[model samples]
Target chain A: MKKLINKPEDFVRESLAGMAVAHRDLIKVNYEPTFVYRADAPLQGKVAIISGGGSGHEPMHSGFVGQGMLDAACPGEVFTSPTPDQMLAAAQQVDGGAGILYIIKNYSGDLMNFEMAVELAHLEGIRAVNILVDDDVAVKDSLYTQGRRGVGTTVLAEKICGAAADQGYDLHQLADLCRRVNQNGRSMGMALSSCTVPAKGTPTFALANDEIELGIGIHGEPGRNRISLKSGDEITELLAQTIINDTEYRRTVREWSEVKEKWVDLELLNKPLQKGDRLLAFVNSMGGTPIAELYLVYRKLAEICELEGLQIVRNLIGPYITSLDMQGCSITLLKLDDEMLRLWDAPVKTPSLRWGV
Target chain B: MKKLINKPEDFVRESLAGMAVAHRDLIKVNYEPTFVYRADAPLQGKVAIISGGGSGHEPMHSGFVGQGMLDAACPGEVFTSPTPDQMLAAAQQVDGGAGILYIIKNYSGDLMNFEMAVELAHLEGIRAVNILVDDDVAVKDSLYTQGRRGVGTTVLAEKICGAAADQGYDLHQLADLCRRVNQNGRSMGMALSSCTVPAKGTPTFALANDEIELGIGIHGEPGRNRISLKSGDEITELLAQTIINDTEYRRTVREWSEVKEKWVDLELLNKPLQKGDRLLAFVNSMGGTPIAELYLVYRKLAEICELEGLQIVRNLIGPYITSLDMQGCSITLLKLDDEMLRLWDAPVKTPSLRWGV
Candidate 1:
């Protein structure tokens, strides 16, 4: 395990500390119950957006904290979920008078902890709600998720919702916009190699020299199947086709109804992508893969998108969300509407993502 | 070696093809001679800035091509410097009415080829000059360089010089500004593991599980020493201290003399960094190192800078310059004056580096 780190246990805090200092102009870090918040947080009358997850997937939840993205991000230990207290503290720190919204990935740990956080926030008289993201079409049930593990779409959802929030959307409007983005997005990932967790001092999993794990999850979770290695074009087509051909996905999620003022379980379904839909295509490196290779994947992916009659109006290619130092990539395709496209193009200033001021 | 590539030979072209498509709004990829130029090239009166090197160091030359950075970038095969023709073609394609400046790294092939390209460009009736970067303090001479090799400082120079050109700095002025930046900067790198080039299916160099190569070159060239792997802080201190304590370096480099209408060798010297100097500290990943790990390194780097009485005015941490998928990082510190700081803060809209706009 040749990682540039100190003690494994200190990895998360130290990295966060470094981030806080480096981006001190943009973000502020709070330790103990570790969470990162926008340096100029708590914009009055603006809904605060918060998200949390495991530590290994960097620049995801924490690096996204800043203007036009996330208000705060709670980080757990490596590949471990943050406790509800951390989320609660983040919400408290960043919540403006408008309200709070938690963008929770649909993993068991994240779901449960964020739900608890919502309840705790409500108990403290804060109007808080939850919007779940489960855009990974590669699995129905995985090691850490019940329906689908939230993958690449979480990044899209954050960007779109962050823009909406910046544009003065209320809590309910932000929730609906986030839900719409999640429903319209699909992702599939494949692993060229497994990532080593610093504490473990070994790779989470292994593959032969000439093999790959298709449809893999972010935390090295087993995907649909392991297969022999193939060309870049072949692998890209496989992942893209799986996402494009997915019929529909239905899942029951808990949501906070302001009218009812209580948590309610609602069954939601995502319609399959159709021809002529415009997309915001994202090709993300899984840590160890180079940006040059992501461009290769993007080349083939753009070809596939064209052949499938999907117009890729916007695209993002790089290591926005990564799994430690794993060598792989994930593709996220989000069907875009006029409003979504406008928000996606809006200004965002985060540590990991920035454009248009 | 598990990489997301098709044919080994097609790796560079395909990746560029992907980059061209993914960032078509920002850049255009030309084939055969193989150079990436800004979509809005020939800025009419602004001096065009061109750079090139091996293909593996992505987002260096090509990805930096956009509105406020590089005007064009020529890429060679993996770990190989570009030819004179590629550079000449790029100069012809992007040369504005003002002139052209080629930001060449201090590698033998790059220096030789770019020198030849300048002659060819002059023969074609286009005014062109060169600015050489040799900021790497790792070794006096290495596998591919005659003096200090250009490492992380190349990125800083391109950005600063690109902004200077955007603000209408003429050819000679841009050359002097670039020389000032290169002279004021220093860098050192370390590698945790080796990266595999596509054609060369084996690792560039091997490192024991419990060892690390300090002062490593971008192309996995042998460094000053290999020792037992240490904690991230210790390693960061080693790299930072080496750069901080480097003595004045003297080298003779070739530069075009517009007045003399010839290329001439000039001996240059760079003084060591002093206390109370303002710096733009850049911590870059060598492809595979995670951004999280870089923050850990940054934490220690920041501490060392304070102890040495240097003030960091700005910072950039990510994989801006890479060596394929090698797990390592490099640190670059550029002393900034009022003009350089202003230009450094200017809007830059590239595929990899974007800020202020």
Candidate 2:
């Protein structure tokens, strides 16, 4: 594979090293049990926020760590979940006197590992809880997820929850806020081409010149369908329509109960979007797609939203979340409430997603 | 070629439409003679900064239009220079009582077209000046440029000079600062693969699976050499070394003279870089390269700069300027004076390259 990397094994470590140096003013890196934390972490009474997943989806958990976003981010190997030790260490490093909240994407490996980390943190006398995000509307279950895959909404959750944490939301309040965001947000992705992992040395999947995989997962997992390549506008309509017309999805999630002092399965459901709802539209590049193309996707998406009577109050476009070098894009629509909109506009000074500072 | 686009002819216009809708809060688009301008244009007496070029190097001229940056931007067809009418229209719309400063990259088509636009503006009694940027150390001449090709340093020049204009620099003073920035900056790029222009429907240039072109131009023009694939670290060393060790370069550039009422050629020379110089290091992706890989480039680049005794006080790492979907990267180092550094830290809220606001 033609990639700018030294060795497949050292890819994650070296990339993190580079990020640490480039953004030293905002974050610091911890090796061995790798995790990235804020430079001035452990604020006396603020609730600490943390998140993690595979390494390939950059600027996600790791790049979001800074002044008003994540207190710490645990980065696993490319497309692999971080081990419990790494997550636990990150929690220990960033936890203040108040509490800690772990923003977990709904992947099997991620759910299992972060659950273990929560238990480990409790054993060390730390109050830690997780808010699971399952906003992907493509498939009910996929290769690495038991339910809907957490996709673009994970980025929205990080920003909103981070701002809420800085706004003095306690651990429980922040967890509820995160869950509300996931319930209101939905996403669907497609891949024009597959990405090659540094270690794999080849594409994770393949497609003919005139074909694409619709509703593809971040890790190149099979989507709902593989079809012939279509125009940018057509593809955007398909993705946005799916998200807009999605039915109420019910799922069982595991959340920590402070009173019970243990995990409990809680049933939750998403509220179907309706006309006149305001949205925070997000158009994301899988990786290899250019920013100009993302604008094309955004252009079509805005039109679809206007037709559906969905008011787009805010929008974000670019490679905020991505799958290595895949050439594709994803559409995410988050129905925003007043509090969510306020927090979304709050100052955030992360390596990625910097504004209002 | 696989790309996310509509008809190739509508690519630039549609992309600009998307940008206008997405960043309506910050910028507005003018059709026919297409140009993007600040939402609050003609900002009283502030000298308006204007830039334009061929499309596809996104977030360059267009995305950089907003508060504390370009007051207006004119976008042309992909890899094709914008017409003088478009530039003149842009200047007319955003020209305050003070004057207009056109930031021109060193390309034959761009220079020629913008010079014509300046003459047209003079006929209309608009005070306009031009600042030329030719910071690439790659070669003395290329397909599109008579002398050195302007590359990554163009982004730095926009940010520094844009901030200066906001800080009350007159048109002539801002033009001088831009020239100083161009003289002290140098860049070099390499490509692992070629990008397909929408209009062309094929790769602009080609490279074998295991080969790369070093010092490649932003338009896929021929570079210094074609060689077998090398490790990312080795590639970084080659590019950074060339930029650091570049000798003094002397060239004559064209500028508009208010007194002469016409364009005049002026000889200019760049000073050789010295040890202990403080730099604002910029590592930019052509397009398709992932953020993780860019960090790898930045990692090696930082090491080399330290070894060369250069101090990096600030850095920008991402796809600020880009080819359509070229899989490669470029590195730029700009020696910073106290004024330039302070202005660099000033607030900018563009669609891309936003910070401190």
Candidate 3:
């Protein structure tokens, strides 16, 4: 692997150290139970928003930890889940009097570990709660639980929910806001090349010179199928059409019930994107893809949205969520209401994503 | 090359088209003689700042064309320099009644094309001037290039001078500011892997698994030497030491003499970086390198600066300047005076480099 790492074991720790030094004003890194917390976290009576998952998908969990976004982010080893201790430490570190909200992506390892973290935080009297994000339309069913994997919507949800939390939303209200954002968002991704995990020392998958993977997961997971190479416009239409045509999708996601004081299974249905829907279009690069190519994807996506009568009210185009050095792009269409629109446009100051400071 | 492009020939134009579509609120693209200019450009009596070069440097000259940075940017084909017409058209489009300042990097093709454009703009009776940025300390002598190649300092100069223009610096004043920035800055780069031009189906150079290219230039140029791969700290010191230790670099650069109406040679010398020097440290990724790895480089860089008694007062870390998908990074150190520091802190809002809204 032609990577700039000294050793696989030291990669994550050293990366976190490096991040701490580079953005010390914006964040402070806790090494032992690795978690990145805002430089001025534990705001007196504010709700703390926390998110955690595997590494590799950079500028996601960790880079987002700052003033207007995540209060703390727990990072695991590359493509591996963060241990519960890490999350517990994060919850303790950023717990303001109001409470904490865990934004957990729907991955087997992530869900289970965060579940334990929730329990541990409860034992510590931290009043921590969580909402599951499962917005990927690539997977057809939740039976395999390699269930609909969360992708680009996690980023959108982080920004919107973090903004809501900043604007005086309590733990319950912020959790509800996060759940709404997740339910209203859908994402589809594709890969032109697979990324190599530092530990594995090779690419996760191989593609022929003329092949491309459609509906790829962030961690180099195999997509629905490999198909012949296509134009940028064609690829955009394929992913956008799948997302646009997807009917209401129902899944059972567990959420912390504030009144019941226990985890409860809530059947959630993602409403179909109907005509005249105001949407926020996000075109994300899979690490290796450049911004110029992402604009191409947005060009075609804007055209498709116009044809399908979906009004794109706002847009973000860049490599916000990435799969380490993977060459591809993902498209996320979140049907936005006035409240969500305001939150999305709210000022955010983070290492990777920033605006309206 | 496994890129998300429809056809190799259509790469530059299509990418510009995509940029226009995505950033329509901020900028507009001029086709035929391709250039990207600010949507609200020629800001009534503001001295316009125009910069351009080869494509593949993702956000360098193109993504930086926005409100407070660049008035217009001309993108050439992949690694080739843009023609004189592109610059002339851009100058005309953005000439508000004040004048124009062209920020040209020190490359043969870019210098020549911009020189021609300067002459053409002068003929058109628009006061045009330029500042050549040649801060790359890698090249040993001008026997081939007057000594060093222009690298990271071009971006720094653009940003500082862009801010100066915004504050009503005339064409000559902005040009002088850009030249001072270029003079104060020094840079060195290394590559873990070579970048492939979209038109060229292979990497510009090859390296073994345990090898690296040191003192490399941005355009896939062969570096001063190749050596066995080392830890991130070792690599960082190797580059930082070069820029920090470089003293009294003398080179002859040609500048357009308005009174003489001809390109004239001027001997330029880069003064040394001394102890107690307050500076702006920029660690830029060459496209494919991720932010996590860059933090590792910065970690070592911060230590060396502390040890050397150099105070880094401001910093920028990311892939602002790039070479397609090259896996490597470059470090730039610009000794900052009070004026330069104030200009650097001035607000800039662009697709790539932005802060201080």
Candidate 4:
């Protein structure tokens, strides 16, 4: 309600305008289609990587567009999926001779839109592939999603897949690599407080002072259940244990097949994490959590990982992915192979995440 | 207060511990007389730069410790100045043979503790100097402060002067560079809400739903006055014009004189900002605000600068300096010369600020 935006309707458009001006050196905005692409677009022969979703999770799709990362990003209204036109335009704008890859998180709206965009791109003679990401361990079974929701691992996938694409991975290889990342990644989130949408001007949900929602989703949805507020270490332990002890989860999800040229409902399974598994532990804020607090969460997460015989080879702690103005955190564990590690370390020059560039 | 801390008393220490583990390769934390130093400390023959203050404004002193930034950072309790022992030990640990320079913000407790630490370091045969930063145009006249409070300018001073020290500037030269940065910068902040200190367990201040504090300090202190919530552009105009139209502000501030071997109260004056001034504009979040909102602030800031005939040659938009869980923003304008611009662009590899490294 106390947001610094002009109007609820103009929020997304204004944010895009501001982003275009702020990071003009790194990215360019196509306002008609509402997508952000690399400043130096159409890389001639490099595979184009595009991802997008609701606008509230900033620095995700838009901020990640630049050298060695996402080539383009389509943004929708807060908590709303982008139209197929926006995604299709973004793909066409950034695609080179190497083809295009769409990294779609397993949200019903995003999946349908990206799938439609892929079909439209096919008609345009652009080879487009989508690797569905369903890494969230929270939503056991709900109409909100087919199985688990895609949460924090989408960030890791974009970074790794972006690097691989930058290194000349073909479209099929890039899609396979993205699928591998999703299979190895798992995420769980909790909300200390709910966020108010600009239009609503009130919190999506409410809780008592001493209570919190443990398994909350990013869009201000109710979690598994409300619980008493606990200490940092206790909360960290709960999240880590849930993710670490998760059994092999099998679900029927949709993936785009280039040969079949249609969306196919395929059964996918997440392999249970094993002892001595190496990982990149990511602690993301749901917008309102501080870095200091995230580090505290990381401290407990590291302890739990060590006790479970898991090796945290790399770590990212910050508000990388978030729900608008929500006070909470999510823990993501991306099981890493040597190639994934190398790709992660590769140069990335996005607005939010940057290193070795 | 709803916070993600283990225990109120252990907040700073635990965050420091987490920072140590999170950025082990970039920084090292020393306990007892707590302070964070470069992992590879004592870069011999280099003038060591040290900055310390309350802990909530993270990534300012601690997160800025690496190859091209602060050599050491001392952290106090949340919103409380660090102890003399911490600063003293930090000065001793990172004092290369060239000397040690303390970047002290103009808060009474911080200035006093840092002054005592400088004297202590001097007794131990370390060449030490202190530069006071008081660029906040808010708090025009308060019994607590002489002229103004030091707010966002501290980040710019540490970064620009840190690069100068890395390039082998002597103690006196580095101190002078820091002083120049402080004199040329002006900042103003506004708070949409107040923050709760961990130990306090309550917000330091309060505001109505339709009200905003125009010039709130980082530690949750009142500013110029409270006003009805305004649009982003209107608020930006007020802050930008206040800083831009500020006339010569003269006050007696203390500085450590290596030659005199004493703290001296010297008259300092900030010249009125005028047309044709090239500035490095910084838009900082008050912790809870997201990158998207910060960009909105930056957008208005840029338009105002252009309208005022000032040029923003470089800009930084993020929550570099912060007040914990407070939703608001601050804008800093540091007039840049060629040398200052060169130093500003220098590579810094700290946990937060990193570019061209």
- Which stretches of candidate 3 lie above 4 Å from their native place? B258-262
lDDT of 2 by residue, B231-324 (tens): 9999999999999999888888889987787779888999878999999999999999989999999999999999999999999999888998
lDDT of 4 by residue, A298-356 (tens): 88888889889999999998898889888989999999999999999999998899988
Estimate, for each residue in A273-303, the C-alpha lDDT of model 1 and write its tens digit: 9999999999999999999999999999999
Best DockQ goes to which candidate? 1
Q: Ten consecutive residues with minimal summed lDDT in candidate 2 chain B? A: B136-145
For each candidate in turn, the interface RMSD (Å) is: 0.6, 0.6, 1.6, 1.0
Q: State the lDDT of candidate 3 residue by residue for B1-357, as single tens digits.
A: 677777778888887877787778889999989999999988989999999999988888999998778999999998888999999999999999798889988888999899899989999988788779888888867676646777898898888998999999987778778888989999999999898887887889999988999998889899989999988888999999988988787888878776676778888787899999998999998888877788778888989999999998888888888888888999999999999999888888887777778
Enumerate the chain B TM-scores of all models. Answer: 0.98, 0.98, 0.98, 0.98
Better of 2 and 3 by lDDT: 2
> A202, model 1: CA deviation in Å?
0.7
Q: Output the better candidate (3/4) by TM-score.
A: 4
Model 4 lDDT tens row, B1-357: 777888999988888888888888899999998999998989999999999999998767799998888999999888888998888888788877998989988888898898888888888898888899999988675344656888899999989998999898998888889989999999999999998899988888989999999999998889899999988778888888889988888888788887887878888788989899999999988998888887777888888899889999898888888999999899999999999999998988998888877
TM-score of chain B of 4: 0.98
DockQ of 3: 0.64
> Can you tell me which runs of candidate 4 are displaced by over 4 Å?
A141-145, B141-144
Q: Alpha carbon lDDT of residue B357, candidate 4? A: 71
Q: lDDT order of candidates, best first?
A: 1, 2, 3, 4
lDDT of 2 at B274: 94
True contacts kept of 1: 0.90
In model 2, how large is the Cα lDDT of residue A340? Answer: 98
